[model samples]
Target: MKDFGKDLDEELSSLDAPPLGDLVGEAVRQGRRVRRRRAVGAVVGSALAVAGTALLLGGPLRPHSGGAGPSAVVAADVPSPSPVVRQPVTGAALLAAVAGVVPDGLRTGGYAAQTDGVNGAQVTGAQVYLTGPAGTGMIRVFVTSGESEASCFTTESCRRDDRGQQVVVDHMKGNCVQDVVVTSRHHDGTVVQVNVATCLAWTEAEGNKPTAPALTEQQAIALAGDPALSVWMTAEEGLRAKAAYPDLPRIL
Candidate 1:
């Protein structure tokens, strides 16, 4: 009886136990499911990292309104630029001024002029040779930067005008033909001297006539009083004027 009971117990236990192959198959399926989950997690993590990197590389995004179009960006206030300034007058312009002030019938023979800084800053000079029925003569205009101490040869010939400008009317003592010089010194330290003479130092063929000059002493004073002839001139204008009279003297 004991032998029979032992065999029965062994059979019952064997029947309750599961198959080894089925257990192995179940374990393999569980391992495959775990691996799949890990791979999916890794893919999701890599995609998130790439998106974060893109956001970091690009600049900060600007805020947008409800409208589809981009909003206008208003700039800060800034100061406006200064206005452009024009340069001073030219030598050719000065020559034209001289021509305008002289007598109506007198014709221009020759001229020599200079702008302020190109030739020299100390003296700005312009000389126009005029010829008319009286005789061929010259009109010289000189403007110095500073005050001139030049006085008349005789006190009787020097007098002050209403504008407080010293006026000098004198004749060339050494020359056979009397040449007149009208000098006016302004209160602003500008010295304008107008020389009207029958003789022109440049040309010997048409000068030294016994007749009066092309312009009279009164006309010379008026020409000297003209504001056209001044020491103020632009460098660029002076350069052009200098080229106008290439063969003539620069600061005569």
Candidate 2:
């Protein structure tokens, strides 16, 4: 689980807001898991409830036994879900870049819509955790799920669609699912939303050295296992992430 925004969080945490620190720590942990399993599933536990896992930004660590995975959302016993990761995208480009490494003959799945919501607002980037066969490349792609113009302040409809959208179907066969959604308060007293999922988070010490483009295995494990991680929100970072992605809601 290589966090792309740890340093900024560290600088922010120097002030106060212990909760934000916890969230950050969890993020760090998730980053580690991604590295260890390459953002895929290495070990399968029991089924995890969609509402059970959320996001975190903390020290590197391992994923707690988050159960297996959610029960398959059979498409009314129909043919199956549609093929996601359509062409014309870099993420698609990247998947094509690594598809040669995936030797399962076929593997596909993606969000319900093209956009997704976090906390109470819509966001572009989504956290996707996948599980692959041993020796098969582990995959994780945070892409646009879909836009949500409907269901704003409530979680009923949004929650169902949210959970369903987070799941990816590989080769028409599903093996991955989203975990949970949690709301956090930033150091400045702002509320932010973060999501989490099951993955073999790599730690800093064992995965890679903390640097500009990577994190180690030890660090990843610490972050995943520890809930004290997932700290708070970075108004600056959020603003930047949102600004960079204009389509995404600024609700964070």
Candidate 3:
């Protein structure tokens, strides 16, 4: 009973004071650890979001193959060219072939047919002169079994056929006015020549010889490029024709 309240108060005051400094330091360290963890979590979340955005915007990603990429495309196949085939023909047949291509209004004149032989190999050819109607011009068609000598002499106007044969068209002056000579060599050793010689004077004139040909440069080229003329190069046909027409005039 003697001063009990006072004794309790004294006892409470005597108890050890709490450690304020240690408690404040511990709280600060805990706060710093939580902030560092939040910062790390934020960085990881941002990286994942960027990856997802790229996947959404761009096309589907493909694993890289070791070789060429999609940009390297392949090409299609191309077909090969066709081969040329030649047929046999006689000198008369050769002239007929030439006659078939000539335009209308020209009259056929005297023709010279010849076959040259060397070591038993014969070369057949022909030359046919044509008189133009209405005194337009004179035309000559020459077919041979070998290359054209006239085509090699001039380089004035030259071209190539579909078979890559050279076609030479020359314009001559002097006795013949506006003369055109078209010559070409075929693949089968056949030469075709078309000469258009127009006479300066009428047919009755004394010394007025043929001037220019009746055909144009283009017409002559087309005639020379005809594959039907290759028949003159056939040995069998030439022999048969020679045997049949033994009295035929030989003019080479």
Q: After superposition, how far is residue 219 of candidate 3 from its true place, in Å?
A: 1.2
Q: Candidate 2, after superposition: displacement of residue 235 in Å? A: 2.1
Runs with alpha carbons beyond 4 Å of true place in candidate 3: 1-90, 117-123, 131-136, 145-154, 162-164, 175-178, 200-208, 231-252
Q: Give the Å shift of residue 100 in candidate 2.
A: 26
Tell me the spans in candidate 2 whose CA falls farther than 4 Å from its real position. 1-175, 178-220, 223-231, 248-252
* Candidate 2 per-residue lDDT over residues 4-118, each given as its tens digit: 3445335334423212222222232333222222221111111111122223434333333455445443334435433332121222222322222322433433211122333
Model 1, stretches more than 4 Å misplaced? 1-93, 114-121, 148-156, 162-164, 176-178, 202-211, 234-252
| Model 1 per-residue lDDT tens digits across residues 22-81 | 211111122111112121111111110000111113333354435544354322222334
User: What TM-score would each prediction reach against the true structure?
Assistant: 0.51, 0.19, 0.45
- What are the per-residue Cα lDDT tens digits for candidate 3 across 1-252? 011233433433443422212211111122111112121111111110000111112233344445666654323222333333223455555555555566667775445454333223333344445556545454445444443332333334667877788776655543242256566767755656555555532223344354446676776787777786653334455455456545544331
Candidate 3 clashing pairs, residues 3+ apart or interchain: 89-231, 196-213, 197-212, 197-213, 198-211, 198-212, 199-211
Error of 1 at 112 (Å): 2.2
Which 10-residue span in candidate 2 carries the lowest summed lDDT? 166-175
Question: How big is the positional error of residue 177 in model 1, measured in Å on the Cα after superposition?
Answer: 9.1
Better of 1 and 3 by TM-score: 1
Compared to the true structure, candidate 3 yields what TM-score?
Answer: 0.45
Give each model's clash number.
0, 90, 7
Q: Which candidate is the best by lDDT?
A: 1
